[model samples]
Target: MAPVSVVMVGIGGYGAEYVAALDRLPLEKIRLTGAVEPFPTRSCAEPGLSERQIPVFPSLEALFQAGCEADLVVIASPIHHHISQSMLALNHGCDVLCDKPLGASIQEASALIRAREASGHSVRIGYQWSYSEGIRSLKRDIQAGRFGGPIRMKSVCLWPRTLAYYRRNDWAGRLRDVTTGRWILDSPLNNALAHFLHNLFFLLGPAVGLSARPLEVTAEVCRVNSIESFDTVACRARASGDVEVLFYGSHATQDSYGPRFELEFEEAIVAYKTPVGDVKDEISIEADGRRVGIYPSPNAGDHFAKLTEAVRAVTGNEPVECGPEAAAAQTLCMNGVHESISEIPTVSSTLRRRSVQPDRYWIDGLDGDLRRCYERGVLPSEAGVSWAIKGQTIDLVNYDHFPTSENHA
Candidate 1:
């Protein structure tokens, strides 16, 4: 059989990893048909892209219009372009492996879903942890009801971001595109640390490819950074059956921490506690004081499982473990987050501090505060913080579009 033809869009940043994965595969298994990168020369893609003599195009349309076809298109582009680019790929009769949180809004996810169905193509979202062997092993147990009923789950990710990180492109930390006015909604929970938040929902998914629907959400959103969206957020979403999922994420930290989590069930508890100052997200499930299972950090060598799984699904006509439907749960959670808060709160001037090495403003002592909320499985309002404002409880049942119209009652 001929190699599965591939075209990778967005070759810089995380896209570099996808290129590396492609390079690792034998050319006979998956061929690099072309790349869609406006700045192929500046991207940090592994060297020898030119030596490989692979073609590169500035945009997806240009690649397809050049009469170049592909079996799969791996998209690592920004949040705003996810829907348009993905629908284009599916319409062209190509499968897609789009990066995580699927698209910018729940509406986009639905649109992509329609496009995939119309084209009879598959769409896989890049929530890599869901594809990891360890996570999959754990999900199987949870799905089989071995853990009894899930009680509640909480996750915390306090990664610090320099000013340059948000300034990287036009959409970084933005809620909407300034020029195009499209929903971007880039934030800590939506972008950098999104995988961990998505993992909770994915693990609780009704099926391997379908995440549990969030019935309602209550969230606190605040910003220490001067971005349209908040830099820090703590949200509690109630899934069907009254199961609770709590998340705490912030870029307003002086030091990097967490992605740590604790999930409680009727019979036992599973948890991962990475020490402070460590970047690796190695996952191990502990129950009843014993380490039940262990797997390498999702960031370890095996995360390419997402890519490999998508490729196999496209070529073999098998089911993808995590698809757009499953990933849409995270997007819904994020959308609810923005909608819950009528207005974002800014930290008090006395508590805001700035760092200069790379230049960023952080809310002093915020890491510990968010950690406390995670430890207790509560949001700031529930924890009785003085400045906390309890956001409106958004009914996510039948919640379809975002920036919900005033007629929504």
Candidate 2:
């Protein structure tokens, strides 16, 4: 097929990384047409990247007007602008690959999903960890019955953020209301906790539907640098299958231990020790009481690289890795976590099918979910998983590990 023409919507932190990933794809399969950053000065105005000559525009509208037609749009913009930008891209017949969290709110995310469905274009969210060589190797092993069936899973995602971190960006800890214009990021649930929530569903596949409300969650949220948002969060939750999952994310510490993912079974412990960044692409499975290290691919490409492939899939008329079900399930999981904290109980009922459209922005329902969870102790689980419908734990066990590392703040 002709190389899938694509554009990077944002040229900031993740945006820069996305550009790097796009550079790694086969030149024939991918083409870097251009980029759209509202703030050309702010996006790639820096010294080094500017000289690369990848044509940076000041607005999405401007990019479209420049007669630059592309098959896909890769968004690395802030959480605040994800939905709007993605919607516009889809409207223009461009597929989208948004950064994780889908949107700052459920409604916005739902709206973006709706737009994708309406446009009949593919939309893939960025959760590069899922595309990791480590994850792929473990997936191969799991499918091959290497460490038996997945008995349990655990993750210690210590992503530290100092006071300066939030202060650095205006939208860092914001609760935005697109209609009325109100925003705040008062806790770790949305920003930091979001990473883990997305990965949980990523590693486990979308076989399990996520309940809109958190079933059970007990978290100790703390504020370290006087930021309005919680710097540290440690909580445990039970999702659609009554599957107990643990979550801990923080923005208070000076140093972060990075994100660590592990899956345990009766046979052995399969773990992926992920430090922050694009390095370390080895998957190690400790089965039969011994650690067997396997290197799947050294080129654990960044989000842009995988996103390029997704775009190619879109133009080529193939399925997407970050499809609707996966995106919705992930957003649902995030809602569950936030609701669990605020006491909003959610039930996953497949019987209730709603069109994937964002009539309401996500942040709008945060307070409501929290209040409901507190009022109703029993959260409704999505009725699909036989393991969940049967009310049986499915013989899965989980362990939470957060040892004190030298990088602790």
| Residue range 205-250, candidate 1, lDDT tens digits | 8777888888899999788888888888899999987999999899
For model 1, the run of ten residues with the poorest summed lDDT: 275-284
The candidate that achieves the highest TM-score relative to the unseen native structure: 1
lDDT of each: 0.85, 0.55
| RMSD to the hidden true structure, all candidates | 2.3, 13.4
Per-residue lDDT tens digits for candidate 2, residues 135-224, read 555555555666665545555544544445566566665444435563333356565556555665555552222212334444434343
Q: By lDDT, who's the top model here?
A: 1
TM-score of 2: 0.69
| Collision count of model 1 | 0
Instruction: Give the worst 10-residue stretch by lDDT in candidate 2.
Output: 395-404
Candidate 2 yields a Cα-based lDDT of 0.55
Task: Give candidate 2's root-mean-square deviation (CA, Å).
Answer: 13.4
